[model samples]
Target: MIIDWQHHMSPRKVYEGRGGQGGVVIRDGKVTIHLKKEVYQVEKHLEFMAGAGIDACVISSSPISVDQCRMCNEYYHELGSQYPDKFFYLTPCLPLNEGAFDILDQGINEYGYKGVIISPQNAGEMLDSRRLWPFYEKMSAYNLPIFIHVSGHVLGYDAYDADYNLNIAFTREADIALNTLRLILGGVLTAFPDLTFVISHLGGGISSTLERIERYIDVRGEKFWTDCGGTPPFGAPYRENFRRLFDTLYFDMAGFEGGMNAVKCALTTIEPNRILFGTDYPYNFHTDGKDVARYIQDIRGLDLARDEINGMLGGNAATILG
Candidate 1:
């Protein structure tokens, strides 16, 4: 069974009132939106996911707020109750606000949420910045992994016109990739070595820039994102940081390209480990799971062991989510 860890459900107002993802039109960078009535509600969303063999999901909000986070978490909590083992969550967090941490703590203890998800799109400030260390410390103490997936969550940046659909789409993986790289080089990972970080969109552009980043590491002789403070690199960076995938860094298969590539890479690069199953659900599949299943069957035919497939589907998740 697949675990859709980065699914989104739109509130009716947002889904119905605005031109949803379907309405985005970009012509020479000019954006026009034709709003459509709600095409998919939670009922349709869950039904499709279930049809696709998804056993669980961690629902996150597309447009985020603390109250919105609370509502979404509560909604998922109810859904999980309805479906029993078929649903679970990475609680949406308002980590930028101090009070948000309190809400997160309550969400976990009171609701038994497994982890906390932070959207890089809507979240204005990167918590890895020094300003957010206090909150990070609390999360670290709780041993909760921080799940970040970029979404179309611009704050005051009006890249769009009247309707919010001015931007082509949000959660550009490239931006989140840069942020993830910045967080790593900026010292957040070093500071919180044990802090679990899960990136969506197959880690955005980082995969493409892997060689450049390594060169930067060799030239600067330091990791880019560090928390050691004092304005720069001190000594030789730890191999643990560079070799982070086996340590703490995780990628969820949450996009079409990203999800597919993530599985391929983990199988080859990490070799026999590190891949976690995730369908970026709530966004319906265009054709159906049949083609994708055939693709998986074809890929699986390439002489990999059954253990690898089983681990990719669930074992890796058990390790990461735990």
Candidate 2:
């Protein structure tokens, strides 16, 4: 079965109306994401999926407020209920917000959401904050996978303030990679070994920089913690533990417009079982449904075993989502 694990969806009304109202910031008094006319049309998504031979898509939204998050989740629940075969959804959540846990509970117990999407940073709170431990602990106990996606929260540096550089340049990817590392180095991974995390955009190009990251851990040894001012979760050989914990994480092939370069880079550091198929639908593949089919073919064309191809395409997601 083919699954597009990172497909995004939002209600047209909400998308059109929300600008600087919720967490969405109107940069220079200009809205960045112009709402597509067909964004709220589920039938169009189904057509795209059918043309691409896609069996399912896990829908999610990057909402602007707590109320908007709940609204989007309700809409997703309605869609999932209406088209059970074509859709599964992630509960959109903002950690550390009032009624955050209540919203999460509603999605799982009331709406039957399969997983949850968490931003890299929320309200200036990074993923490693101690306040987030209870949230993580609850998710771990529920056995719901966490999807780490960058929800329009860019790097705080002033350098990216112009030209939408955060979205257009490498800054967004860097943010994801940095936060993923934060979760590892900041003791979150060590604290919750059973939790599953699927990062989008191939973990923001992590394969290209993992060697340097691993080497830092290797060279720093114990002093790394001392200099950084954090207690080392495990003993010596931090590099090995880093790899072990990293291997437990999953990555989705999305946001690259079906290009092989990013996939090849990811293959260097990520295993096939740790990869899932995704078409950043309506964002990257909106114009042509054939593009989705072509993307799938590109993965199939890779010089790998049949099992590996099958796993990357959908089998891996099936196993993980189950």
Q: Roughly what TM-score does model 2 have, to 2 decimal places? A: 0.94
- Candidate 1's C-alpha runs over 4 A off are 10-40, 121-123, 154-171, 222-234, 237-241, 245-247, 257-272, 298-303
Q: Which residue runs of candidate 2 sit more than 4 Å off their true CA positions?
A: 19-25, 28-34
TM-score result, candidate 1: 0.78
lDDT of 2 by residue, 47-105 (tens): 88888889998898777678888888888877876888888889988877898789889
Taking every candidate in turn, the Cα RMSD to the unseen true structure, in Å, is 4.8, 2.5
Give the alpha carbon lDDT tens digit for every residue of 1-322 in model 1: 5566666664554553343556553433435232333333666655655455556666665434566666666666777677676656667776775467766877788888778787664346753577768767888898987787764543434443444443434435555776776666667776777788777766663565666666666565543434343444224553344645333577766565333454565444344455555656545353245443543454456456888776665666777666
Measured by lDDT, the strongest candidate is: 2
CA error at residue 93 for candidate 2, angstroms: 0.5
lDDT of 2 at 293: 90
